[model samples]
Target: MKRFIGFIKKEFYHIFRDKRSLFILFGMPIVQVMLFGFAITNEINNVDIAILDHSKDANTKQIIDKISASKYFSIKDFLDNERDIETAFKKGEIKAVLNFEKDFSKKLMTENQATVQILTDATDPNTANTISNYTSSILSSYQELLNKDISIPYQIGVQTRMFYNPELKSVFMFVPGVMTIILMLVSAMMTSISITREKELGTMEILLVSPLKPFQVIVGKVVPYILLSVINAIVIILLSIFVFSMPVEGNLFLLGAETILFIMNALSLGILISTVSASQQTAMMVSLMGLMLPVILLSGFIFPISSMPFPLQVISNIIPARWFIIILKGIMLKGVGLVYLWKETLILVGMTLFFIALSVKKYKIRLE
Candidate 1:
């Protein structure tokens, strides 16, 4: 027990003595939370739009007034002709063009129906879809106001319920994804580099030649990283809960267990990397280029896997972070238990075993 305590103390000394590691241990979670919460968001406001109101009547004017009053869009240009719409869009002056049919008021009163065409640049499909929805909602509200003055025989309304995110805030999705990425970066990349550093410095040989076994040396090197990763996870969860107002609806114990499982998987990957790499630089480069990039790009962190190219989509299936993120969202946002997330949890366990086996094989080959 005393020896273990001494070992833990030594680990703390090593962590505190290295300024870079110390900074990374404490700084990364805060920076990641701020970046994901404020910067990366799907909710857009003040998008510029162009109006081409051909009707120039009371109905068109009223609709335009309503649109302008809303905060979602800012009317930047008023097009005189159809050609102006194309020119303005080409010049990137506006994201959408609102076109009102000629004699809109006359048609609505006499024909009891009129059509308004909303033309949006589909270059960014998500933004385009959001703008269309906002415009439609404004139109619907205006139609509802008009309907209140008259009596209708039958009325049908569709009710919508957003399951996980009632407010549809993008941060709800981003929080868990960002947390997973930070854990991967810190636990896997840092451990790999630190272990390889001892090998590069000839200290690993000294430890191996001493009374300590190969497994003990590796365990000693990784123990600090595991503890640090747990702290980092706690920090990230706290930030998501308090700072971002994100909910953790599942059992806290389950969340902690899954986090530890992912950390173990990441640490095993680090051990595998350390076995393969001879120098700290090689380990860092491999961790960043080989693991980090795939985890970020292919793990459905920012881009949806369903939307990726066929080959990339297939490749994404193997990224551990992808499954972990799905598990996290299920537990954190949807309030699901282990029954729903067992498949993902099992995949992470399988990956950890694979990494451990590979590292052991490689380490044995090195000894031979």
Candidate 2:
């Protein structure tokens, strides 16, 4: 027990002595939270739009005023010709173009309806769709105001219920993803680098020459990381719950268990990387380039798997973080239990086993 305490003390010393590790350990969580919370968001606001109003009429003017007044869009430019629309878009000044047809008010009075062409830059499909929706909503509201005295024969109303996020807060979506990324960074990247550091410093050889078995040394190194990762996970969860007011619908015990499992899986991957990499830099690069990229891109954190290219979709199936993220969303947001997340749990377990097996094999080769 005294020896174990001494080992843990040494581990803490190593952690605190290294400024880079300390910065990553403490600063990364806050940075990730801030980046996800403020920088990366799906919600659209203050979109710049250009209007080409050939029709100098009250109705056209009214529509333009309504659009400009609404919070979603800001009129960036008033163009005279269609050619300027393309030029403005090329210059990246406007996201959308609202073209009012000639004699818009006269046509509306004579024909009861008028044509207004909305030409949008579809390069960013999401922004384009949002701009279109906002424009349509503003026009509809204006029409409703104009027809306040008249009553329609039939009216259809859409009651939209955003199931998981009623407020559509980006924090709810990002908390899980940020947690996953931090866990991956701490457990996988840090462990891999730390383990390889021992090898590079020639301490691993002395440890191997001592009474400590290869497995024991590896376990001792990893156990502390696992504990630190669990603590970090708790810190992040508490921040999300108290600060962000995020809900944890499922059992907290189960969430903790699954988080430990993910950390173990990540730690196993780190061990495998350390076994293959001779230097800490190589391990860090491999963990970031190989593991982090996939976890962020293909894990359905930032992009939907269903919308990805078929090959990339298939490739995403093998990424352990993908399964972990699904389980997280299910338990945290959807309020699902072991029954729904069992398949993902099994996949994570399988991955952990595979990583362990590969590491053990490589370790034996080095020994022989």
Please provide, for model 1 over 28-52, each residue's C-alpha lDDT reduced to its tens digit, 9 standing for 90 to 100.
Answer: 8789889989887888789999999
Clashes of 2: 0
- The CA lDDT at 122 in model 1 is 94
Candidate 1 C-alpha error for residue 244, in Å: 2.3
TM-score of 1: 0.88
The best candidate in terms of TM-score = 1
* TM of each candidate vs. truth: 0.88, 0.85
Clashing pairs in 1: none
